[model samples]
Target: MLAFLYPGLGHVYLREWLRALVWFFLNVTSFTLLMPADAVPETFGWSELVAAAENVTPEAALALAAITVFSMIDAYWMAKRQNTETEVEEGTTCPNCGRDVDSDLEFCHWCTERLNPESDEAEETADDSGANA
Candidate 1:
């Protein structure tokens, strides 16, 4: 995915604006700080880093690009893992009684009507063995 090749894009796809902003800020800041200080003349904060990268040997450029690409991949993996856990949590809540239920439950454990009824059968089912005793 193109999102995995560019940092913060995956968060944007997930609609997490604050996370995207933080990821972009942190990556840019760290990249700026890690470049060799005297390798390039400073202009703006970012211009110095861009100049340093451009002036570097081809191997250095490749290494920096690889690092950036891996960071984006890490962000995408983290977002997907978080989204999956959230979906699982959302699906397991009981709608009728607001109780936590297993994902496979057909009816709320506290209220034993089908999740949806046909309207012909009574909502409540009586236990007849207790009555016979």
Candidate 2:
């Protein structure tokens, strides 16, 4: 939501401070560079609109529009990536089948093999040896 509306907001929400800062800086720079040289009038009127329009360069406007669209897409992508990572963390990869599964599941969906049995046994042996020492 924030990211789509404001560049770099998604990164900030995702705790990626560096990305957020960089994105914000780039967005600001794009806007600054694209801004018209002519000063707009204090009052909103047809004359001011015409003047502003006259000062606007087509290439600059196009560049600014591109930057805005790119920022929105980047923010959405980062948000999706963060969500996918969260999902992965809450799930498990089946050792025998190499498939993603719920963390609570005990068997692999593809291979139908018991999950983590060998690793569990190895861990148990290591723990026992450490306790004995």
Candidate 3:
């Protein structure tokens, strides 16, 4: 998938903040390390890249190219897998009490109150009295 083609995109889609950050840092670091020394000094312009490639040994350029290609593939694959798994597990969590709820459920099972609707004032008063005992 195109997600794997670019690292961190998959994690972004999945809403995995830490995983996305790690993927971004890793891909960037690897790409930077694999690039030629001259390539590091300048903005990553096409001409600079070409000049570096022309100056560097063929073996170095090939290795760098391989690394960049492989990293892209790795990122894409990770994103695809994360997206699939996350979609299956996604559900709403209660903001007030931190309870997990099914997406279809409008109320928290534990609290037995309307999640997004107006709560009955009388019911709340009765519950409060019971809780104080």
Question: Candidate 3, after superposition: displacement of residue 107 in Å?
Answer: 24
Please provide, for model 2 over 1-133, each residue's C-alpha lDDT reduced to its tens digit, 9 standing for 90 to 100: 6766777887788788998898889888877877765743567899888888788788877876676677678777877887887765533888666778877777877789888697779999999999999
Better of 1 and 3 by lDDT: 3
Clashes of 2: 0
Cα lDDT tens digits, model 1, 1-133, are 5444566677787777886777677667655765555556666678776776576666555555765676577667777787787774675766677777776767778876455444324433333444666
- 13-99 in candidate 3: lDDT tens per residue? 656678667767866776666656765537678887677667676665675556446656666667678668766344476656777
lDDT of 3: 0.65
lDDT minimum window of 10 residues, candidate 2:
33-42
Q: Model 1, stretches more than 4 Å misplaced?
A: 1-38, 45-54, 88-114, 118-123, 127-133
- Report the CA-based lDDT of candidate 1 relative to the real structure: 0.64
TM-score of model number 1: 0.42
- Candidate 1, 24: how far from true, in Å? 11
The residue pairs that clash in candidate 1, if any, are: none
lDDT, candidate 1, residue 19?
69
Task: Give the poorly placed runs of model 3, Cα more than 4 Å off.
Answer: 1-5, 41-46, 55-133
Question: Model 2: runs farther than 4 Å from truth?
Answer: 39-54, 88-133
